[model samples]
Structure formats: C-alpha cells, structure tokens
Target: MKWSEISIHTTQEAVEPISNILHEAGASGVVIEDPEDLVKERTSVYGEIYQLDPNDYPEEGVIVKAYLPVTSFLGETVEEIKVGINNLITYDIDLGHNRVSISEVNEEEWATAWKKYYKPVKISEKITITPTWEDYEPVSSDEVIIELDPGMAFGTGTHPTTVMCLQAIEKYITQGDHVIDVGTGSGVLSIAAAQLGAANVEAFDLDEVAVTSARLNVKLNKVASTVTVGQNNLLEGIEGPVDVIVGNLLAEIILLFVPDAARVLKKDGYFITSGIIQGKKNDVKQSLLQAGFEIVETLEMEDWVAIIAKNSADTKEG
Candidate 1:
C-alpha cells in the first residue's frame, strides 16, 4: 500500500478549524493528535513511584492526518494521491507565523494497512457500530443497531459532528413521532432516530453515494420501511411537515436552509442541527431566529456544536 502524509503544524488553537476546513474540502477521517500526546512513556522507581516524561517535544503543534486506502487513493503509482495532497491548500488562514508541509510515504506494504485504524464505535449505551463485514449480536431488548460500510460518505458516527446529532435525537425523540433528517450521510442520524422510537423517518442526502450507503445501512438495521432514504438536497422535493427535523450539515448550509426547515416543520416541532465549528454557533442561531425558531438547547462536543430549536407559530415563512 502507498500513502501520503500531509502534516499541518499550527498552534493548538487552530487545530479544530483546520480539521473542519479539511473535512469540508474532501479529506476523509481526519485524525488529530496534540503534540503533548506523543510524549514518550517512561517508568522509574523512586520509593515505589513511577514517572513518564517527554523525549523531545515541540513547544506547540498538532498533527492532523487524513488516511486513505491505497487502491482507492493511490492506485498503482499513487500520483493522484500526491496531487490530492498538494491540492489541500484550499484553506486560507492567517497562521500568525507557521508553515504547512505535505509529503508522501514511499513504501511497499500490504493493502489493508489502514483498516486496522477503524474499530466499532458505540454511539450510545445501547448502540454499537459493527462494520458490514463484521458479525454482531444485538441484545433482544435494545432497540439500537447500526450497520455501516462508510465507503466514501461521511457521518459514520465516529466524528463529533455525527455524535452531537445522534445525542440530540436520542435525548428528545418520542415514540411514533415523525422525523426527517436532511443531509443524512450514511443514515446514522435517521437510523438512531428510528431506533429511538420515532414512528416514521425520511432521510435524504445530496450525494448519490451517501444515499446508497444510507439505504444499505437502513436495511442493515432492518428499519428500511420506517426510514425512507432518498437523494435530495436539503429537503428539496420532500413533502409534509414532520414532528422532528435533524440536519447534520456545515454552519453555512444550516443557515441557508433554516428558512426551508421552518417552512416544513409543524408548529412546536423540533429542529436539530450540527456540523458547526467554533465561533459560528451564533450565526446559526441568528438564522434560526430569523426563521422563527425558539432556541431549546445547544450542545458542544470537542469542537463541534449542535442546536435544538423549536418552531413556534409566531414566525412566518415563504
């Protein structure tokens, strides 16, 4: 297998924003590591005491990495992967005084090297994610089951953005409530809503791959009928008002779609949105306000934020 390592050395404060930019720019599965975490482990005995110290540490830095499979990313020569790395400078940031570097890993290894990095991620106490190829046993009592093969789509429930949306739905979803999930990737949010007892749910994604993956995941969990998967851009071509609506999308998309969300939401319905980076929560909130939503609650996990807003009768929509 061949891989390219693109390392961005920046102050710890910029790590989250940089990661978000990279993700929005088409990088998959970004892994961020604070320089302090790389400190070497040591054991010494002083009156039965043990100690660990750093061998060598940069004053401040973080390694944000995006790993891709060789066959999918590099192929035979890996020239495309190299180009992809070079094209990753899409982020425009005033880094004070820092430089980013992209390099290639020229080596020969087995094809499945990066597969070991991914493991079953449990979204909640009752939910355990088992890859499509893996065998899993779902307890008869628990209603949660998520089977996924994250091919190229996002939101496999490992990222903070996905987790926040799932947590919000689990906290408020009631049995037999109608639910709608916009920009549903891999159908994680909708599946969780279904498992949590929403009577009927419809999930849509702009990407065809995401729609396909979401459909497979819905079937994997045996909730295909209750949860409809379709190809739509932000609820376009969908009809009717649902009891609860969830959108796991970037802050910009959330703001742009807030009015449309209000248009289809029933009076006093719930609206949950995530994929918000730091310093942008207020922007989404204001958009929601202008669209006639009353703020219910907001959640923050790591650098991602999710807002739960309620549609009130006082607001008018186009």
Candidate 2:
C-alpha cells in the first residue's frame, strides 16, 4: 500500500481548523510540526519527553501533515481541502503562508514514523493523555489516563485548548452530573467527563468524520456506555438543563451559540469554552455576560484561553 503525505504550511492559530479540514477530507493521520516546540520548555513533573528534530520543522509558521491513501479521488480531495482552508479567512483566522505540498511514502514506513512524536504527557493535575500504542502506567493513585489513537482522530487530546477545557471539567463536574460536549472532537472531553464520574454525557460534532472518530475513541477509552456521540451543529436541537456544557471551538463559533448554551445549562451550571485566542478573550467574556452567565474563572495557556462561566438562574429561555 502507498500513502500520500499532505503538508500545510500555515500559522499556529490556523492549526486546529486546518487539521479539521484534513480530517474531514479523510486523512488517516495528522501530525503537527510547530517551530515553537524546538525552544518550548518541558517540565518533567508532567512527564513530557522532548526529542524533536529542528530539521523536521519549518523556520517560521507551523506545518501540519496528514496521511491519505493514494486513490483515484486523491486530487479532488486535495483541492477540496485547499478550498476548505481558504474558507477559514472569513472567520478572521490568520493563515500565514498557507502553502500546501504533497509527497508519497511507503505505508509501513509512514505508519510507525509519526508515533515517535507522541508520548504520555500529563496535561493537568489529574489527567494524562497517552497514545494508544504506548504502554503507560499511572504514577499515582489519583491519576487518570486517557489513551487516544490520533491516527484516526483530529488531535492527540494534548493541545492547549483541550488541556484547559479538560482541567476545567475536572474542577467543576460533580459525580453523576449530566454533561454535554459541544464540538466534541475525538470525544476526549466527553470521555473525560464520564471518567470523572459523570453519569451520562452527550457529545456532538458538526463533522460526520469527527462524529465517527469520536465514537471510536469513546469505545477505545471504554466509556461508550456512558458517552453518546452524534452529529449536530453546536447547541442546536439540544435541550439540556444539563449540569455542564463544554465547547472547545473557535471564539467566533462560541459566540454564535452563547445564548443557546445559557438556555440549556441548569442554573449555576458551568459552561467551559476554549479554543479562544488571547485577543478574543474579552469578546467571549462579553457574550457570556449578555447570555446571563457570570464569569467564574479564566485560564490561559500560551496564547490560547479557556473561560469557565456559570449560567445564572436569571437567564431567560427564548
């Protein structure tokens, strides 16, 4: 078998959305090569091992790589991916160079090569995400391990937005609480909510591929019975009164559904929003305020932000 590696040279801010585009186009595996990783500090407390080669990364911007099988429809798929990425500009996302390239490789070589970049890294006080191929044991009695196979998913569940969202979920979710995960890519948050003792979880994604990948991951993490994966736009047709609502999506998308989020959440329930850039922090905060949510806490990681807001009892349902 042969695989074609599609590489996109773009900005760090564009990585998540561009990766989503590739995943939607039937990419088998996605790998991100950010130049920042070369000089970024890693703490041993989190058990992160950094063995990155500078040569593998671009001098500027970020390079996102994905593997697709060489097929008759390969060219059309690539063109569609390009169009999808270009469409992102309307959202005010920075694309940087936005150059794309492709190369062919042997299946055996490509399958195992990208695995070296992923290792068990503790993302929070209680949660550590490890690749499915790695054998990792919990170092403490309270530690929780999430095993993910990124080859079939959108991300490795270790991005800053995801980490902050998971940490917020761990902090707020109560035992047997009902949680709803909006834009539930890879179903990581839904799985975590269940693992943390949530009685039930509703996970949703707009992309059918993401819905499929997330369901696969929920089963892989052995939480399928507790977490339900489906396809739906953010907060649309969801009648909650759920204990918690979490979304890790672009700030613009988050803004679009703030009122719906407020309506579905139980009074005093938490809304955890991530994938927001630092500059857009104030905008999200204001939206949450208008939607009758009181800002509870704000979390920052690098240039990304995650906000935890509480839906007030006074919030009116339209």
Candidate 3:
C-alpha cells in the first residue's frame, strides 16, 4: 500500500490545532518534529535520553506530519485540511511559516517514520507513557505506566499540556474520587486518574474519532470499568459535583466553560487546565477567578502553561 505524507511547517502554538485538522481528515497518525528538541535541555532526574538527529528537523518553525492512504479523495482531503488550518487565525493562533508539502511512501516506511518519534518517557514523578509496541519496564516499584497507541489520536501523552494535567491529577486526586476529564484525547488523563485510584472517571471529547480512540486506550489500560468515554462538547450537559475536573485544551476553549466547570465541581474540588500558550495564560487565569476558582498553582513547560485551580465553596452549584 502507498501513503501520502503531508508535512506542514508551522509554529509550536499551532501544532495542537493543525494535528487535530489532520486527524479529522482521516490521517492514520501524526508526528511532530520540532528543532528545539534537538537542543532543549532535558532533565536527568528521570534519566531521559534522546537520539534526535538535526537532519530530521527544520531550522526554524516546527514541522507537523501526518500519513494518509493514497485514496481517490486524497486531494480534497488535503485542501480541506489547509482550509481548516487557515481558519485558526480567527482564534488568534499563530501560523508561523504555514508552508505545507507532500510526498509518497510505502507502508513499511510509513510505519517506521512515526513510531520512531515516540518512546517511553517518564512525564511525571510516578507516571510514564510508552507506546504499546515498546516493552518498557518500570524503573521504580510505584511507577505508573500508560501504554498508548496514537492511532488516529492527537498526542502520545508526553506533550507539556498532558504532562502537567497528569501531574496535577496525581497530586490532587483522592482515593475513590470521581473525575471528569474534558477534551480527553487518547483518554490518557482518564486512564491515569483511574490508575491513581479514582473510583470513577468520565472522559468527554467533542470529536467522535477522539472518543473512539480514547475508549480503546481506556480498555487497553484496563481502566474501562473505571473510566467512561463519551462524545460531548466541552462541559455541556455534564452533571458534575465531582471531585476533580481536568481539561487539556486551548485557552479559548477553556474560557468558554469556566462557569460550567465551577458549577460542576464540588466545593474545593480541583480543576486542572492546560494547552494554554504563555500569552493567553492571564486570560484563562482571570476567567477562572471570575468563575469563583482560586488559582492554586501554575505549571509551565517551554511555551505551554497548565493551571491548577480550586473551586471556591462560595461558588453556587448549578
């Protein structure tokens, strides 16, 4: 079988949304190659190692790549993806170079291209994410392992936004707590919450493809009984009073449902939000404040920010 490799040269800020566009266009998997990774300082605490090659990355903006089978509708699909990415400007997202290119590869090459980008990495103190095909051994007795196959999903659970959310969930979640995971792509957060001892987890995603991918992941992690996956727009129609709520989504999307999040969480319950760029951090923080949430902690990695807020008892529930 032949596959078309679509590569987009864009800013790091646009990676999330652009990858979503590719997935919606029926890409089998997405791979991100950022030149910064070649030079960024990695912590040695987890003994993380990288074998990145300078030749594989662009000198300036990040490159997002996705693989699509050579189908009769491939041309139309690519055009639609381009249009979707351009429309992101309305949301104040930076496109950077935004140059797109395409090439052909056989099935064997396509399989190896993306898998090499993912590996077992310890994102938090106790949580480590590894691709399903990797045989990873836990470095510690209490280490939590999450095996994920990106499939048609957006991330491998190693993205900064996801890392912070998983860390926050580990810190705040009490045993047997009920967790509501908004924008639960790949269901990584939901699976982590369950592994950390959450009795019940409700994971919601607006995209049906994501919902399916997440459900499959939950089952693979043996958390299906604890984590329920469904398709829902943000927090709409979600009845909460839950112990914790976690959303790793765009700041604009996070702002849309601040009040809903506050209403859904129980008094003093936690809300963990990420997928926010540095420039929009203040906007999300202020919205959380106005919605009766007290900013508890802020986690930043590279250009991304994740906020951990607590719902105030004075905030009225819906």
> Which candidate number has the best TM-score?
3
Candidate 3 lDDT:
0.87
User: Which regions of candidate 2 are displaced past 4 Å?
Assistant: 42-49, 154-157, 314-318
Residue pairs clashing, model 1: none
Candidate 3, residues 147-229: lDDT per residue as tens digits? 99888754322677777888898899989999999999889999999999999999999888899899989989999999999
| lDDT per residue (tens digit) for residues 1-318 in model 1 | 455555565544355445545443444445454434334232321011112123323456655555444454334323443343344334332243345555555444322333433445566556666567656666557647677765543221266677667768888889999999998877888888888899899998776656777898889888887999988879776655778999887676788778878888888989999888776789899988988899999988656788999998533333
Tens digits of per-residue lDDT for model 2, 1-318: 999999999998998888888888988889888878667676534434455577877899888999999999999999999999999998888999999999999999998888867778787789888888888889899888898877655332277898889889999999999999999988889989999999999999998888988988899999999999999999988886888999999999999999999889989999999999988999999999988899999998888999999999654343
Decoy 1 TM-score against native = 0.69
TM-score versus the correct structure, for each prediction? 0.69, 0.93, 0.94
Model 2 scores a TM of: 0.93
Which residue pairs of candidate 2 clash? none
Better of 1 and 2 by TM-score: 2
lDDT of model 2 at residue 147? 84
For model 3, give the 10-residue run with minimal summed lDDT.
43-52
- Alpha-carbon local distance difference test for all models: 0.66, 0.87, 0.87
Descending-lDDT candidate ranking:
2, 3, 1
